[model samples]
Target: MANPYQPIEAQILKTIDETPTIRTFVLKPEQDVPFLAGQFVELTVPGHGEAPFTPSSSHFERETIEVTIMKVGRATTALFGLKAGDSVGIRGPYGQRYPLESFEGKDIYLVGGGVGLAPLRSLFLSLVHEIDKYRRVFLRYGARTPEEIVYKYLIPQWEKLKKVDIDLSVDVGDKSWVRKVGVVTCLMDDIPCDETSSIAVVCGPPVMMKFVTFKLVDAGFKPENIYLSMETNMSCGLGQCGHCRLGPYFTCKDGPVLTWEQIKDIPEPFV
Candidate 1:
């Protein structure tokens, strides 16, 4: 058994400036770290402190992992200062993962917004590993501004996969932007998949998830078939702390990824 509280040593391999506010850290862990798609790890910046982050890398690769970060507060700000060769503490590959088994014969719709794409990217990479097992894949991404988009470098590769279609949009346009412009729900407009044979995964801000959920439902997705990644309020990777409470559930242990049916009754602000 591994100690949940003790962090393993991980060295930063490189850092990518995904956007002005977001950065992706590639690390070489001291030991093999195996985690499924949609799960997250606790990253400790030495004396600065530790915080939770989803590995943006493919789960198929255990020796290396990628964690994308946004400079929001103290912990992240400290994380931003570190560069390649810097040492950081790491623990866990915690929480529930997406139900790939259930998605085997189903079409997949991945909707990501801003940094929320981090976990979705992990899931996407995992799915692509066994692409022939599933039917089709539709990836729709939305950002506040084209400048805020992450993973632009991987777009071409993801689009090249067989039976996969990728589209990008922004809520607002800039002089340099020429793609579709609107909310993420706007991408959900045409209702691409057969609701009964498809599953939808969404990750983003609370408001974005809410509206996206509504859109998915209106587009014929069953409440049980839509999954949401609520990687928020996670102060403790273990379930001991109640910091990530969402009504009666713990976002850290019980979720980080939950179906709409599981969270629909959790009251307001939780969609």
Candidate 2:
């Protein structure tokens, strides 16, 4: 068996600045790193260490992978210095993926905040790839301010697709912003799908997820039907590392994707 700890060399094909603190790197690995939506990868920044990140690109596209990262710590700061053509290491495509099969024939509601939108982009793209299988796709996203919104370039394109609807908001807005001004949860007030038959996927800051969960529950979304991307301190891509333990499960192994019902009883799950 191949050593799971070993990382394959990948070249940075390009980089796109999404915000002052966020950027997207397009990489071409020496070998294909196939992963389903919601799975994550450990990105190594040469001399610096590696950190876990979920790919922001569609899984259907095999030639290259895109990872959207926020420059918050040592590894990510080191990554910010590298440019196109620079080399990095990639390990994993780790953790459980979003269960796409279960979503078929049901309306899908995606709620994301700030860079949390990264992982959801992969899920959105996958759904769009086979648009006929699903009933409809509703995207509700919010950023702290207009400037911090990632994927600014693609949101319009996504909104134009048939069967997809998008609602955007910002905690604070400037003159150029014309969208709703409030938290992402505000967008949920006028949910266009049947709460009983739809699936809601959420990924964002812990605080945001916590409140969003409360709002969804209040809105009548079944706990099992609410999926969350809980990418906590996943130091290792394998289960042997105990850093990411949440009760009996390891985030890196059993999930980065877990249903709200599975974690609702865990004390401070959003924390």
Candidate 3:
């Protein structure tokens, strides 16, 4: 029997560059697809091939889905040429979403870098829907340079919210830019967190993960309380394919979200 929830090919409604190398593709699926925040989908560009991408849109909306893609390799290069009305395949809303249940009445910190913010944005928007559920929410985001940052439009709105704390940074800045300058970890120094009561969700490049994890540890975040989104070259999201296997783990399956405590013994360099 065919899976009732199989992905339907969607039409591209718009493609806008969020940054120098990152672009957000707005898609209208043939049918409505609902997914929790933090899940990923497999996107196919027909003959050009496919890859995994987390939806950047809010989980509350289903009429349209947004995916932010970074031009990294051949598949992504083909993706850049996609235009409004072009057809593309989207197959999921898979994997785990941020554990909202654990965040109740606790300080929640979102640490994201570059395209990693794509997924974090979904989780953040969900949190905003029920603002009072969390005691304090902190968003710390960074990018290679000022121009490389995504979601420029939403920053002001989030900042306006009394319950949310938004801090941003850039690895390198130009004369016109004015904000914190350094890695996303730099913002950590300013946020107040309770080691046992707060949850820190981080996503970014592999090296950035290493350093940020160290900072979170030094600041007293419990190893298990620190969640992460890992990346790998994935295809055939169903664990049958070996494309994304890391030993006994499948990044597309058991996680793209895990705490350091779960995979610390894997001997794999995870992000």
Candidate 3, residues 92-151, lDDT tens digits: the string is 767777778888999988899999998888888888888889888889999989889898
130-234: candidate 2 lDDT, tens digit per residue: 999999999999999999999999999999999999999999999999999999988988788899879999999999998998998888999999998885798
Ranking by TM-score: 2, 1, 3
Highest-scoring model, lDDT: 2
State the lDDT at 21 in candidate 2: 98
Model 1, 9-109: lDDT tens digits are 99999999999999999999999778899788999998888899989888998889999988998899999999999999998878898889999978999
- Candidate number with the higher lDDT (1 or 3): 1
Clashing pairs in 1: none
C-alpha lDDT of all candidate models, in order:
0.88, 0.93, 0.84
RMSD of model 1, in Å?
Answer: 1.4
Instruction: Report backbone clashes per prediction.
Output: 0, 0, 0
Ordered list by lDDT, greatest first:
2, 1, 3
Cα lDDT of model 2 overall?
Answer: 0.93
